[model samples]
Target: MFLDNLSAFLTHPVTGTVLLMVGIIGIALELLFFSSGLLALAGVAGFGLYFLGFYLAGFASFGDLAVLGLGLVLLILELVVPSFGILSVLGAICLFGGVLMASSDPKEAAFMLVIALLVAIVVVIAAIRTFKHRGIWNRFILKEQLTMSKGFTSSPDRSNLVGLTGEAITPLRPAGTALIQGERVDVVTHGSFISVNKAIIVVEVEGVRVVVKAADDQPNH
Candidate 1:
């Protein structure tokens, strides 16, 4: 009888609704507060478990497959193309659809949604515990790991601004604009805001950004 109750509890409408709420909240927090540490990983894991539970409950359907496909595509797009919100929007839609499809009934779907949401909360909490002081994750799911996998790739140098002298087109209050070699470029000052049109000398060159200081302050140009 306990097994029966347990099964019933798993399918309970209130339980599912709670899960869905927690999942959505987790996803929202993860996406919005990206710097919130391990929240993002927790969100992903929560979404996975939510659907996995629904599928195991024999509530899956054709719609769930479509949702899974769309989710995967959207997820891939996120990694390929960096954007502010496209990935998040598509991800949410796909996740919602997946939950909806997996449930045998609307009631079950609702229940699963709640459960999934709760799972997201738990994952987030756990992630916070594990990754609190660590650096970025940069994994496939997190994308932090992927960046680390690629290592530090230097940017291309298109501008031959090295060893060139120019004037400040705009005051760089630490980061400002300076004209070098007839081409206007952004530059960093040595904690001094060079006045506009101030004669500046390039001290070092790295990638596109040039470091500059007042021409008079330079010991060697």
Candidate 2:
């Protein structure tokens, strides 16, 4: 009984399109933000519901599911291991292909997929510009502005601070301010928390990122 209703609803163009949009957005959120698992779950549920309905209605074949699964696996692998966008592109193709195969009408499904993809892109852009959520984009997007083409020789010289010891003026719960070389500079520890007033030393400086380590943690020169 419930399956019948679900099948009917999912088969409709409008409802199905909405579901697809929601599913894509959810998946984008899962990939973009590194936070609570709720968004990821919601995205998974959207895909699950969409496919389940199609399966119950006999519109989705094992081949379609296999394609979608393969696509998703590639996308996840892209995140876990860097493939320089190769995996991402391939994954998106398979994902859309699978969804289109199970769709009642290929035309409507393609149109709807484009819309959802656009919306998801907008969401990602907004998230990148507005919030500092520190998600997958940090890895994917290049943030350095000081390049030779831009009239700057290097990424804002902070290399002089290397080997210099400093004091954490603020709590470095991995990221905070530290007094280094007589300047209050923004800094980050090596994935460890250093309490206020703890001794620290400059370790690595890449581009604008300043990495510090606990003074005691550093080996003797």
- The lDDT values for all models are 0.65, 0.79
The deviation in Å at residue 1 for candidate 1 is 9.7
> Poorest 10 consecutive residues of model 2 by lDDT?
34-43
Could you give candidate 2's per-residue lDDT for residues 77-147 as a string of tens digits? 76577687798789878888988887767787788788877877887678777775477667666777767
- Provide the lowest-lDDT 10-residue window in model 1: 134-143
Tell me the spans in candidate 2 whose CA falls farther than 4 Å from its real position: 36-38, 137-221
Compare the candidates by lDDT and give the number of the best one.
2
Clashes of each: 19, 0
Candidate 1 lDDT, 1-221, residue by residue in tens: 66545546655566556556655665555554454536445555555555555555666655686786577457545545656668867876787777777766866575556566566677666776776544224432453444434764456563466567789988778888887778778889768878888989887776766788888774656
